[model samples]
Target chain A: MTGADRPGEFELIARVFAPLAGEGAFGLVDDAAVLTPPPGEDLVLTKDAVVAGVHFFPDDPWDAVAQKALRVNLSDLAAKGARPLGYLLGLGLPDGWRTEDAEALGRGLALDQDAYGLRLLGGDTVRSPERLMLSVTVFGAVPAGRMARRGGATPRDVIVVTGTIGDAALGLKLRLDAGLSGRLGLADADRDHLLDRYLLPRPRSAVAGAVLAHAGGAMDVSDGLVGDLAKMAAASGVAIRLDASRVPLSDAARAAIAADPALLRTALGGGDDYEIAVALDEDDCDAFVDACRDAGVAATPIGRAEAGRGVTVVGTDGAVMDLGAGSYAHF
Target chain B: MTGADRPGEFELIARVFAPLAGEGAFGLVDDAAVLTPPPGEDLVLTKDAVVAGVHFFPDDPWDAVAQKALRVNLSDLAAKGARPLGYLLGLGLPDGWRTEDAEALGRGLALDQDAYGLRLLGGDTVRSPERLMLSVTVFGAVPAGRMARRGGATPRDVIVVTGTIGDAALGLKLRLDAGLSGRLGLADADRDHLLDRYLLPRPRSAVAGAVLAHAGGAMDVSDGLVGDLAKMAAASGVAIRLDASRVPLSDAARAAIAADPALLRTALGGGDDYEIAVALDEDDCDAFVDACRDAGVAATPIGRAEAGRGVTVVGTDGAVMDLGAGSYAHF
Candidate 1:
């Protein structure tokens, strides 16, 4: 579990990917992995999968399952402004575990592939019968005319987002309920910063090329935020809404919502938040929250996009309510 | 089991990726997997893993488990000379199975991602309690001065291969001994071409850039041509020998080695045989067997490269015979 202690897959990939820092030139211990682009750019591949009781909770903390499987495949290559470049894992592991719990899940995948300049390049390991499964697959490049997509949102765009959203589904309802940890008396550093944002979720690949140089459609919320903005408003056919008091919480979610307001249903049905939700264009929403307050990150806004389709919301007597649906779907 | 029946995961990705056909440029339903490079070239990557009773046969056949998980990840992007350019799956399933056997294993992974031009892009699916596991990765591009590596073989190279190698380990020991299938008199089209090379092991990515424009070290024969040419003679440190009566066999391996010479020990330790083995340069081994007979394929040569380190077999009175300790290693 995040209590850490397990390291061997090549010494946890030489201490989590031999200290990251690369911008392509290939060479990630041969047999394959070589990228190059970056003088006009193009590439953008992506892949995701993290099952274990269907994605996390097999005692979380193999360094937050190797930083939420390399920040949810670097939030789908930072919703397409790409850049990152380098990744390819597939792990499985299960037979009575331990090879140092797969060397602390390969030193949490070589510390998020050396903190993102990536280059774990190739991978594949097996033996499974239950749980522990990863499957990353990243690679980026961008710049062949700003990437972004989610069927290029429209109906007057605007949604926004970026950081704070249901502290990773209220840190998975405080690790799957003990009656919501004595109904939110949750201290010990606000339950270890909401269990490290549901086990480490960074990937805003640092404002992916200034939201693909402004935004119009993008994604990465890993479900919830009303089921991934109802799958980016049914892949951009359009109709959004929102409001329920402009969402953005976190002062440890208003002290666990003044100690239990049904912890606002884990801030509207929690879901691992790798952030970046975008859509923008209400004149690039105040220059995209003033370029996320001059790149300190945090953006926000929360709703717009209308004209026939799903989402909706409003509340506080301002009519229309029922936003239920949450995340983790399986069927 | 592979006899069909069981589906869902979008009807096994619309029946194995609705008849695939990619090379990227928007396909596998998009949002990544685009690749473009050609007027220059570079991208290359690899990944593998197959597990289920550990790589095949828990009653195999979800279309040869989606064609040996996209032919052992396009045999590591055809041992690195790159070409395919797309792939990324991570299935795991098992639990009240049958959505058309997970759409016959997503129509055997969209018929090997439309027979190798890859493009499946996004992936991940969970739930497992019994067997079935896969984890491909692939990608390719090469050409920045023709890739090819393994520590460039030397000391008089010339080993080669390409096709026919103990019919996928005697079609997985006649698909796990049905009392050695009536004592190996085979036939049923030589037990369905040696159990479809033990369930689909092809990946030669159309002769990976003609084995890096004519070998000097290459790989991809999933362990067994004397242990992947002694890992291409210990990653080109060099010593290989072979000449076991010039390998290349198939009349269903000379009618199962004229009814058992212990089926050439299942073709010297029957591993998958995604073929390709290379080494060449004893003057480009007859122009790499005339560029695999001008691309009609089936190269052969059987072996060479010496000056010492391991792997040995001499016979016809030249003594030194130890064809034992090589293939089948997992621990």
Candidate 2:
């Protein structure tokens, strides 16, 4: 930060963005960046924006907040079966923004850039009078004509999800309710797991190749699983039959659900789970599962597509239930 | 709007972004978009943000706000000689934003889409607790290894600036102080000229080809002419000797300066002049000027690079003058 109460635009680039912007010069202050797309690959572009309190806790660590911003966009890329390339950040700092807050943000971005194998290309930083906001535009590449889409699932497809789904949803619940840890009699590790998952998403980039190879259609579960599945059904003109018992959950989520059975709905309907849910040809289902396993991701078969419309979820009790308005709408 | 107090995100994409996103279906709600660059062209990317009361008047027409947001990035692209291709928008809306504002924003984008030949790839609209802000990430295509840069000038180069300068700076002054119009005795037409230039930027996209063909180095003058010229000199590691009297001024700016001779400083050191300044080989300067003229842009030789550092401004009186800290710095 500048010696003044807050950093100027140039100082903002040199410090808060330097760690992630790269070695030598900060491209953050440059006019523009130029790159050639890899041969025979189409560039995949997606943007996701997060605001203080709306998407994450305003007091959340800037590093994790930076990671959350990156991962949300990365999740979109992975769902499209694209390989990570780079990203541009648009950050809006809150009033009286301090040097430490800015440094922490840059540190968070630097850490995630290493972990996710992408670098900051270029970006813009601005001032916000009230809350902090981050807008991340991630660019990736997929082989020509091979990017997964949301409209290809058919009656011959089997549905599967990568990684546990409900951990983040339950984590969000616990974060919003401070007494939740005690209400559920959770261990410290479980509490941390839930809170961490809610704060930072683990995008399924590892299985992007497998999904590209075998999935007929795919989407990242950012909104509630049931609502997203319903969207998939509508887009593909098919019906999906999901077995709720087959839906994977982290141990922490299971603990929470065990304490309050009603929380199961929250697990199924809450947003921020950056897991890929894909529909594969029945014949390719085993191969896809194996590929994900090799990628060190847990893949569980959860549903099937049929020649009809809408999504159905049968509970552990073998009875159909209403999921309600589960999809997260950001308006 | 989504028939609620405000538009839901899906409805937002469907209505506000439809005109710019295209007709058939809104890609706004889709997972991601993929595009392959044209053969033999490298992608050029840049992002710039505008905020209410900061970049433009908070109550400025949404269309003008949208255009200003867009032109800032387009200016970057043109300075790099990149042809417009597409863009992703990240909008943060203040609490209680209305339907009209959203639609006007889209309409403005749509008008520019047709004028500038770029479509919306995708975007996100999120809620802001306070002010409305827009972050635009624009993408363009430039011929391989041909994107103009900020550094490459030498003692052998002559500096030329495109279009006129200082209109916007004076325009900004008129906007911020309604009484200034009367004090300057600005006619209605003259006042409108300054105010219009401040509210909107006419990016030098027309002469991009000319610049790429004959310029040694280039940068758009967004900050004041003197300050930006100083940056160009610093970046290229060359000293620039500018004849301040040669700096072109529009009719309105000239009229304002004629009324208040002291306002000449504001004209020379004002920001938001979205004009291109280039350093060209003395031998190639005329051809560059000719090419720009043929493309319907005015190009005037304003300065020359010398074997030294920093930037010098020679007044109409033929005396060296300090232009103050003329560059616009965003804190």
lDDT of 1 by residue, A1-331 (tens): 2224544333444454444424332333345666666768777878777877667878775667866887888887877778776777676766466656565766676677767777666565555656677777777788875678775778878788877888877877777775675667777787778777877887778788778888888877776687678777877889888775676777787688778776665676667777878887888788877776776788888788877787887755688777577555554
- lDDT tens readout by residue for model 1, B98-185: 7666667767766666677666665666666576777777667887756787657777687878778878888887887766756776
For each candidate, the alpha-carbon lDDT, in order, equals: 0.71, 0.86
lDDT of 2 at B33: 79
lDDT of 1: 0.71
RMSD of each: 20.2, 2.1
Top DockQ prediction, candidate number: 2
Candidate 2 Cα outliers beyond 4 Å, as residue runs: A1-7, A16-19, A22-29, B1-6, B22-26
TM-score of each: 0.38, 0.96
> Which prediction has the highest TM-score against the true structure?
2
